[model samples]
Target chain A: MANVLIYANQQGGNLSSNAREALAFGSSLARSANGETAAVLIGPGAGTAAKEAIAFGAEKAYTIDSPLLAQYQVELYLDAISEAFEKSQSTILVLPFDRKGKDLIGRLATRSSASALTEVIDFKVEEGTVHYVRPIYGDKAYGEYTINRKKAVIGIRPKSHEPASRDENRTGDIIPLKIDLSEEVIVSTLAEKIESALSGVRLEDARIIVSGGRGLGGPEGFDELEALANVLGGAVGASRAACDAGWVPTSFQVGQTGAVVAPDLYIAVGISGASQHLSGITNAKTVVAINHDSEAPIFKRANLGVVADYMSVIPALTKALKKRMGVNTG
Target chain B: MHIVVCLKQVLDPELPPRYFKIDPETNRPDDGVADMVMDSYAENALETAIQLRDKIGGATVTALCLGDEDSEDVLRRALSFTADRAVRVWEDEWENLDGQAVGHILARTIQSFGGADLVLTGYQASDIEEGLVGPVLAEELGIPCVTLASELAVEGSILKATCEAENGYQVIDVPSPAVFTIVSSEKNVPRLPKVKDIRLSRSKPIEELEADDLEIDAERCQPAVALRKVYVPDREVACEFLVGEDGPELASGLAGKLMELKVL
Candidate 1:
């Protein structure tokens, strides 16, 4: 049987949301292959994460507990996970398409002499063969690929698949694997971590995002967006133009070359929606554009187009939202 | 110290969506856009390498790319932008190679260079967005790799890199003889080639390496993933312009629409 193994990625001792999606995809693939689904959780509190993976439809879970694997050091994690993968003897490996997973899948595939497909948005199994679908040419086109190798590693994009509902009564075996990590191989060491200015919700996780562009005039313009985001309980993002103009950090830039986010609501202020920028937000459920230029390209892609100056419109919109949501404007 | 930056040339990603067209028979994008440029993130990686060479005296920056003859343009562009040497690995058969095959070829190419103290690549190529080369190359070379690094500095045999993490930016320090995948940042905005330098870059010879010369096994270089089909997705949403004469009116209209959508 072609066992499918999903890497249940964890952060700060908690299971990541992406891990659930990967597990769900793995479960479906395993069922099609007439095999079993397993999860490999490598980090602290792997035991707890394994239990959670079982609730998400995994038949078995492997936990590699180690102190050195606490932080996301590539070498250490790869060593630990590769060991778990061998233990499971799975033919198909599913991973998340985030920064860490993107970095790991390729290396793991190479080490195991397997084939790999990255950033897969969907998949299908026909006659026991799997086809992975992904976006190409900056999301201008979608392409489906089928791996020819005996083993295949696939990285699934976040939010592409619906996560399977958790079943508290579901039970599975948690297998613990021991790893001996050496300090000599730890060439890369984390020196410091600087938290981003806006903390509560990450742009990817935020339901609503208030994004600004060059028309915001300067860095000061982001303050209004932050206020709107706060009122809406969301996050603030910036166009590449704004980030390149030094109005905001590159981390806040949302475009093809920057962070690709899909929120429920994306409000673009003073932004001319360039195709590159639109690719990142195409997955957003509802896009609202507020631009002074009536013919800005962004209006074609937005769900709601408001032709006006954002300086006058953003504050007004924030106030209206506060009043409608019954949030006090103190 | 010798630093090698792997570069890939791709169609300009900023091309308007309406202009993009895919050929059904070939299952590939039509080469309609005239301007083919270096991948933005690769430019960032090249910029990072150039900056490291500037910061540490006597460092050599070599740019490597694996593509068709048209890919030479980007190599020359890299030379004009301050890369000291350029190498292109191309063969007609390479057209069908997957990311894994490409990674093996790159690792072999780096090994043929005697060895490099550092290697850099873009976080992901804009075309296929596979992002498999850097880490896989590092694995083949048996070196550590740091991905999505925005800032990098070299001091003696130690390399320091700052990368964006889930919560924030994480600063990591690694020993030399490693690989880093650079992400675009303000500090790494590529410098435009000067007119004089652009003219001089023509004379800068780009060393070409064939797949045969690299002693690659033809069978091993076969693509691991086969492309089944390519097509454009249908537009799902039709934009609706809000009917309002003023700012407050527009704000209220948007708020009302949000309520109607049950998202408020």
Candidate 2:
């Protein structure tokens, strides 16, 4: 039986959206396998978050609430998660492939001796075994894999699955797991969690993005991109090259190793599309490229391509956009 | 401080997309199309290790890998640029091992080395991109793991790493004998090997190891995850080029099309 346990993490007294997505996903997968979906919500707001998990379709919610479990110290979190896994007797575990998931999953799977699957975008269940599909070669190809072991731990790629819709009337069991944390030893206290710490529209939340690249040559071009982004009410993003050259903060980088964004409109300015950058925009609804190189690989993925110098093109585009949108500039 | 950096030779990720192909029988990237190169992330890990070693004063960086003879080239590359020693662990019959199995072999190999102060690896390999090795290795060794570090520091046996988060980064501190999976940053971009160093690396002996040498569980090394199939995902978008008399005209035309499509 595919009893799936999802770590429905909460932030600011509510179940985070990604965790909801995971719970929704686990519920669907469990139903397919004729099993149940349970969520382990840890720390301060976990009791409240448990209801949210049920709203998102979890059949059972395992709450591990402790003031000591407040912050996400990996060792403490891992211990609690392990306790929930055992008590719930789940065969499969699912977590969102976010920053904390990357930190905790390997250890969790290792402790349980479960097969670890990373960044899976698709999955299939046949004869009670799960098969996973993940992007490889920077999303140039897809590879499908199945776990031979009965126990499996999966890290679901963020934004790959839609957020689970909520139903307030949906009810389920809430099991509060009693766990001992008095003996857990951790050498490190993670240097505090600073929420987002970004000004204006956060890149992850941004619907429209104006991203620059090495082709900008220097930091000044980002100023123009910033101006355009400002008028369009979007976030500014950079490629690894631009960020590497010290033109922008590494946080602004949009690539495989950087922030993965799924914006509604992505404008690539002066960027020669590399797969690392291409992978980040896989979910973008519309891609527009403005580059001098006509043969830049980005053109293949761009919905609209313009071969030109971004310096002249960006200013014109901004002005044209203002005129087209009927926005008055005094 | 003694740091061991795990390296893997993979299909050159920078190869043109059109040249990419998978051999149906083997379900592996066609070796004919792409030459194997040191994984980009491994190079960053090596660079990060070397930098940390330099900071720690009189430290050694050992290069480790689990691959065939062709894998030695990457070890040599590591030797050329700051790695003090090189080791290769492989079995003749071992082919297409999953990340968990590879992690087992690596953990056993490290155990044979009597352990070290730190272990470093790339966040993930470019080919399979599993990213399970570093954390799994840490688990097998019963040590802590801090992953995706953009910057690392060694201060009196405690290792401090600045790791990437969603919108910001975190500074995590772990004690000695821990695992670190490095992510590339401007601060850790790999440095090139000098010609003299490259020539000297060719003469340096690469210590070869087998499953028996480390007493690894050969049967247990079997893949936890098995590859079912390999296929290319079609993501082609027909692009419409905007031509104009000048830059302004092109911009205006592009803007008009976007509006028509209701993209903005």
Candidate 3:
């Protein structure tokens, strides 16, 4: 049986959601292949994290507790994880697909000379050979890839799979490893500066999104959408056209070249739904469109459509929502 | 400082895929193989890094890849374009691996190179468009990561980058020895590889590394996602016809039809 090692990144002594996803994925693969899954946590006060990882499905948990591991330092992490992987003789490596995961995978692949793959959406293991499926061509095509190595590392995209359930009764051993990292290779961290944090949740993670387009007029119009979004407990999104017009940030754009969102509720306000834009939000559970033009493409995709100017309807909706929710703007 | 930009050759997008192909008996244009070219976004990212190195001095740009030896042609082209050096971690088997696994091995190789102050990568590989490598590599390295970077400036030890965020441009100040994933921007447009530079690049170098040489878990790199099948989308648009008295009437009717379809 192959030994699988999953890096369980401890975020404030808890397992990151992405890490759980990796654990669930690795565990399922291990169970099917009769392999063993080991979770490795590297950071200060990661002992709890190591144990929690096991509770979530790992057979064993590895912990590397050091001052250098406290903050994310690229070189130090590479050194530590590489050392851990080397010592464990792990055959399969797993990590959450995120910033830290991305950095480690490429550099680790280079240093370790292992085969690697990224952003795979599905997988199957047959006779010990693993084949992966990923979308290509703007998700218009799906490609299958088979890896020909006994050992390899993969980063799992977040929210792609359900996380393994945590069993409180389950427990595992924490094996601490020694890896030395000096400050010479370290550079800096987020602690060095204070960022101007946003007041609301990030658009990528929000459950609901109310987006606007060119018809919204200007940045000032976003205030109404923002108000409506706040009333609906959702985030705000924008079409590429609106973003290009400098009325909104490109990050809020939902389209072929922008972020893909699959929210529970997606509201298109005055936006002519273009194919490129629809591709990003097609996965939303429920789409509602409000536009003056009855022929707007967005209305076709929307489950519910109100053929009216969004400016007139949004304020009323917000007021109704606030009144119903007993929320006082004052 | 030495930097490396890994590029992939991909199908061109300007000429969209032709979905329906008439049988040879009918002589209809088949979905011609999408013409292949260097990924535009990656090339732009490479240009940005190269320009940064040129402006700051004391930086070298190396192009790396883990693709078929034929792809060596692509790397050579990248060298001819802007990279100072080229290295192909040639492996015929890698053609099937996912981007995440590829990134894992690349990280290892980069780690072996040692002491790279900054690692620059494209926001996403055009072929897979996973947009995960730069972030995942950053996590693996435990370093600060700035992705979707539109503008970047390196001042002493700090890497100040302007990234496209949800609200407005976010100016991120990260300490050097960092990694950034570059997106396409006007500033990143690549100039043609000078004819003399192309000649010089041939003499530069192309080193090869075997996947087995890195010595990490051979199986850990297995893919998470598996593609079960690939079939072309059915060409099934029901064209709605609208008849009217005149141009405006016809336009309004078409608009009404669009409204009926809910696509304006």
Global lDDT scores for all candidate models: 0.86, 0.86, 0.69
Pairs with steric clashes in candidate 2: none
Using TM-score as the yardstick, the better of models 1 and 3 is: 1
The candidate maximizing DockQ is: 1
Q: Is the docking of candidate 3 incorrect, acceptable, medium or high quality?
A: incorrect
Candidate 3 residues lying further than 4 Å off, grouped into runs, are A126-128, A187-197, A213-218, A239-245, A250-262, A269-283, A289-330, B1-9, B12-40, B43-121, B130-148, B156-159, B162-180, B184-264
The 10-residue segment of model 1 chain A with minimum total lDDT is A321-330
TM-score of 2: 0.96
Query: In model 3, what is the error at residue B171, expressed in angstroms?
Result: 6.7
lDDT of 3 by residue, B1-264 (tens): 777676776655333434423234322223365556677667767787788888787789877776766667677778787677777775566645566666666677777667466777788765567665675566556566677776678888788877655344566778867778886555676688889978877777788888666655565465534444454433223323333444344433332332343211
Per-candidate TM equals: 0.95, 0.96, 0.68
Counted clashes in each candidate structure: 0, 0, 82
Error of model 2, residue A131, in angstroms: 2.0
Q: Give the per-residue lDDT of model 2 (tens digit) for A55-139.
A: 8888889998888788778888889998888889999999998888888787788788888888888788766666788989877
The DockQ assigned to candidate 1 is 0.74
DockQ-sorted candidate list, best first: 1, 2, 3
